[model samples]
Target: MSILMHVCTLVIKILVLPLQVAELLGLYQLYKRVFPVFIYNISFSYNSKMNDKKRELFRELLRFSPRAGPLRLLEVGCGSGANFQHYPSGCRITCTDPNPHFKEYLQKNMDKSDHLVYEKFVVAPGEDLRAVEDNSVDVVVCTLVLCSVSNAPKVIQEAKRVLRPGGAFFFLEHVVDEPSTWTYFFQHVFQPFMYYLGDGCEITRATWKHIEAAGFSDLKLLHFQAPLVFLIRPHISGYAVK
Candidate 1:
């Protein structure tokens, strides 16, 4: 058993060496930029199989009216622009991300989204979205973002602040699992290292609690387990109207 543990530790050290070197050389930014493509390819591929079910449940929330001329959307993290193809026609999206490296990936996704208008990309954090005005956008979309923000409440407030009165905040996030579960135990034990491995992602964030406290009306949410994404298995997804 001791020999097996030593082997596991050695493997971990070997795996982490590249990450340590990237941080030391200030190439972590470049890593963060290129990393999402691989992750999104996996995640989106899995989720695409369920897109028909999702559309049946939440298509109305994502769709906009062409009669209204144009609808504005504010995507908080917008990493690698994974959600661009999901937007309705005539929607103009302003994507914001702290990592400037995502600019290239986002632009490429924008080019593919022929239905949605590519507004612009802002290099900013979700916690401070001063670039957007109050109650201006029709929707605020946050996917797999709140768990990584330093202050989730502040980011939620910012999402609320920028949304028009009747507009909604749509989110898809991974959260900590329920207590006493084996997955929860592993998630808790490995949480600290998740920041480094997942680019500041918190495996145990009570994101649903923060969203509930944001004072949004007509709140609706769903909690489910995703066993595929090893580090981020517990997930919550839904929308809240402001």
Candidate 2:
């Protein structure tokens, strides 16, 4: 049994080396070209467990706000425009992502959705969204984003700054696992590789804590586990009013 265990561990270690090499070569962007499709497939299964919770939360918030004109949505790190299908009809959307490779995917997704008015795709990080005007957006949507940003707080601040009064900030993010657990320990242990392979994602970010500290009114949140059994399973989803 001991010899078999050792062999299994060795095989796992060998498998990780190629991934590490890819990271060192900065091929993550290229990797992401196809990775987004894989993620969407997994997400279709995984997110169904949550009953389309993020989309539900977003729609519920939108109902409360006046829809005098086409509701303006600013999505930070809107990778491949996955959330575009979830939005209501006749809405204006500005999708931002740092990866230029995503432009083709974003356009493809946008073409599928007749309801969304494609504003533009900006190549910018979440921490700085100067291209978006202050007090202009009706809602700011961020999902699976905060973990990978260079600065989480600045992203929150930028989100706040862009939202019009009574505008909503909806986020769904995988947070750090509880302390003293094996999962938490391993998250930290493999954090460097996680950052490299995940495009700067920190598996152990206490992002929900930062959201609470951002000073939003009516800050409602839901803490839940994803269907997957991984260090990034502990997640928070909800909205805060600006």
lDDT of 1 at 158: 98
Candidate 2 structure quality by residue, lDDT tens digits, 167-189: 88999898887776666766666
Clashing pairs in 2: none
What are the Cα lDDT values of the candidates? 0.79, 0.80
Q: Which candidate achieves the best lDDT against the true structure?
A: 2
Shift of residue 218 alpha carbon in model 1, Å: 1.8
Q: Which stretches of candidate 2 lie over 4 Å from their true place?
A: 1-43
Question: Which sections of candidate 1 miss by over 4 Å?
Answer: 1-30, 49-58, 62-67
TM-score of 1: 0.83
Give candidate 2's TM-score: 0.83
